[model samples]
Target: MVTAAADPTPQTADAQPWGRVDDDGTVSVREGDDWRVVGQFPDGPPEEALAYYERKYSDLASEVTLLEVRHRRGGASAADLRSAAKAVSAKINGASAVGDLASLDARVAALTETLSAETETEAAAAREAVDEAVKVRTELVEKAEALAARDPRTVQWKQASAELSTLFNEWQSQQQNGPRLPKSTAQQLWKRFRDARATVDKHRREFYAELDEAHKEVRDRKTRLVEKAEALAPKGEEGIAAYRELLDQWKTAGRAGKKADDALWARFKAAGDALYGARSERETADAEASREKIAAKRELLEEAKAVPDERDLAKARALLTGIQRRWDEVGRIFPREAERGLDDDLRKIEQSLRTREDADWKRNDPEQKARANDMTRQLTEAIEKLEDELAAAEKSGDKASIAKASEALEARRGWLRALGG
Candidate 1:
């Protein structure tokens, strides 16, 4: 096969350099130091015979390039790439190709080393992500567990329930989108979360159950209150005080459910409305019936007004006494408001007359008369002394002394006259 050193030139399609054609059309490919028979191409030319096998070598080189591309792009798993690289290496080692087969094997080997490092790094990252995900999921579970551990009575049920629901939604989202944790850890965390949720659910049910019972009791109480309030409605305006008492009771009555309370209150308030309505109607009737009495009282108030203006104490007393007698005769006014106003007006007039009468009585007292006489005597003596001083000042032509004496005498005389001296 080493005839004159077999063609060691680079293979080409036309030269068929990696192969030769025998006279009998037997083709042989150059393999190391020997020529190995490949196939017979009795009907084709030498170039065609070698070109057919050259196409095979091209196909093999293409496979190696594709594998390298896949490895570079991370399009296949590391293990899958390794397996593929081995297969391609085997194909290239003794491949029917006439191109650089050794170089292709070297490229596959480099790809295997690269894939090993990449696989290790990716595995570490994936493990870290899983651990972090477990930590986050564990935190969520702990939060839910803490919520479940809260005192049921103190927990604001509405807010707690909303938070629990939000936690559940977050758990589902993490499960679907976050890194997958180990099966055992995942199942354990899920069980804990589910139990916490179940505990919250149970507490919620129990809390609402107690509230419903309390609400039912309140409803029954309000229902009875409503019946009692309605019973008072038949008594008309006379029952207004009783209805007011029932109203106080209604205020003290605890709450039922919203719908029930609203409905029951409507009925109870209607009963109260009936009582108030009766009172309003009665007031209207009384106001109409009291029209003449109001007029009579107004006339009396006008007559009594003179009592405060009376100059004669005895006459004012006589007039007030007559007015009081007639005021009683005028009878009661209705709606009471107008009655109170008119009575107040008349009483003020009477009080004025009484005050004047009291003054008069004080003036007529024997002790008062004695005191006045004594005062008049003292003033008379003081005036006599002042007159003497004025005369002396006039005789002496002392003008300042005369003026001062005159003023003092005049003041003393005025006091004496005021005492009815």
Candidate 2:
């Protein structure tokens, strides 16, 4: 038969209550009106352990389960709860359980390891993205630099440069946050930059090629003009015509190199000057022949002036008429003192004949003397008008008016001299 155990002291309402304990050895003690769990523990339980705690104390299984769910959702996992429970139990026991502590420590360590791995994976992905962005940015920058070096004035270059600059800036910002690029991206960027550079170079080469061709055309035209000018240097009148043609060609020809232009001009000028000098010498010889003719005309003038004043007026008149005819036959005199000398001598002879005619008219009848007086009055009026005209002409320095007034005065003097006779 079984022996009955001694009865324990009965618990009263005033006595300190036994606190609830979870399956994982987490205890919940009553503090005033509320229940406070001593430590957190895993939610899954040994069913008997949980039932014992519910029976010993007021039922709190539902509240404990709710707390466990809240903790789990808030990043505190079953392993965290278990680790906390072991720490609390060790403290309460006042005896170090190295093995229990080690098991709890191992669970925490494994969780930490998993978190670190996940962080490393995310970091690596971020680094890769950054690297790709950096590669793109570097390519954009190089392309922009090359385009800028080309003609900045062109619309294409300017637009391309601006776009590249903006893209590069964005790419650099991305690179700062991301990882380095692989070899493929780097090569692609370099190729784009090189293509831009090559395009610019091609444009420059074409520009220079056109310029060189234009210069060559100018040089050819100038060379041909120089040869033509040299060829016509020997011909006198013909050379002048050729020289004009050369000048026209020179104007039509586009500009040559500086040295070539100067050399060609000098050669052409020298050839033309030689031809002109020869023509000038021939002109001088013709001028000498003209001078001789003027001298002969002047001698004729002096001979006519030396005609004697005789009673035989008819003979003298006939001689003067013959001299006048001879004067007409002579050619143009030299434009010098010889021409003036001829004019003076001829004027003297004409004045003497006019005086003789006036004397003859005065010696005639009373009707003739009346006519002479009337003519003299008219002459005096004409002289007075001429004097006024001469004064105006002198004031104005009008050579043509002065000459015309002088001729009128001389004609009036002839009329006045007839009156004296």
Candidate 3:
């Protein structure tokens, strides 16, 4: 509030220097250096007229003060405050108000300048936000396009689908929370993201559809295989061979899905287990029947090791021959792997005997002995001739011929030594 005394010696804004009440009841507001008649107030006294216009000045001052406070507090936008300030300034200019109108205009102009800089700062921040938003959206678009470009045949559809969904969710979140992007950039990115998402979805659907068809084919084949195996159940133990053939076919059959394959395999395996169970019962009987033979063969095998230990080749052969005769008498055993194992053990003993016989034959055979004796005779004759030549060279004092003859004679002696002659 402002008050003025009728004295005109000195004034301030509070002293109401800008307002005066005329003796004729006219109210006036001051511009910089001059005063303008605002209105006539004949119904009031000088003080009342001045007070009336001063109240108007107070309202305008409050508006300016409010603008200043709002600018400091920073909830309202700077541009909005600047607009309000312009309106306030218009009201204060040439207003029928009087307490320091010039000062209010100065405050409004100063506030407008501050607001202009604040508005620029806000615009720069918005641009930065928009740029950041574009960068984020571009990354999302690139990632989606990368996913879309994968080979559908090789893609792990479940994981890829989940990843695509997550990327889409991220895109939506950014769209909702991030700053607005340029229309062109936003539309382009969305088109790329949408196209890529649609492509991934299309590929996923087609890939799964093909996989389901393939699974159906495999399922039908495996179902028929199960039926075939089940049909073999009536053959009991005799059906094992046929069941083995069906197993081979089953291995060639492509996979159905895990759940379906597991269910189908249970049926197939149950059928196989039935056939094998019958086989197991027959094997148990055979094993019982062959227990005696297995024991007998085992005993013979323990004794057969002596065949290799025998120093006399003839005795070793005789012992192995007797063991083989006893082995034949014991006859076949059960569970072919066990029979094969036993046969292999015994065959190893036989092979040992054969190897010993071969070595002994090479040592004492008449033909080989005769050939060795012939080679010895040839070497002896050659050695004797070389000795005579060496003696002649040495006696004649021919150093070159002596060395040649001595070297040949020494080589022949070494051959004789190697032959143990």
Summed backbone clashes in each candidate are 0, 5, 0
Alpha carbon lDDT of each predicted model: 0.82, 0.61, 0.88
lDDT of 1 by residue, 72-162 (tens): 6766778778778888888877665444445567778898888788778778988999988898889999999999999899999989989
Off by more than 4 A, model 1: 1-124, 244-253, 351-421
The candidate 2 region of ten consecutive residues with least summed lDDT is 1-10
**TM-score ranking of the models:** 3, 1, 2
Instruction: Score every model by TM-score.
Output: 0.65, 0.30, 0.72
Which regions of candidate 2 deviate over 4 angstroms?
1-209, 298-421
How far out, in Å, is residue 313 in model 1?
3.0
In candidate 3, stretches whose alpha carbon ends up further than 4 angstroms from where it belongs are 1-30, 34-77, 94-98, 117-160, 163-167, 178-214, 280-291, 308-312, 334-345, 388-411, 418-420
Over 1-421, each residue of candidate 3 has an lDDT whose tens digit, in order, gives 2224542223564554667777778787767678788887887677888877778888888899899998898899887898898999899888987677777888899999999999999889989999999999999999999999999999998899899999999999998999988899999999999999999999999998999999999999999999999999999989989999999999999999999999999999999999999989999999999988889999999999999899998888888899889999988899788899999999998888888888788878999888878888999999999989988998999999999998988988888887668
- Model 3 lDDT, residue 18, Cα: 67
Angstrom error of the Cα, residue 252, model 1: value is 4.6
Pairs of residues at least 3 apart in sequence or in different chains that clash in candidate 1? none
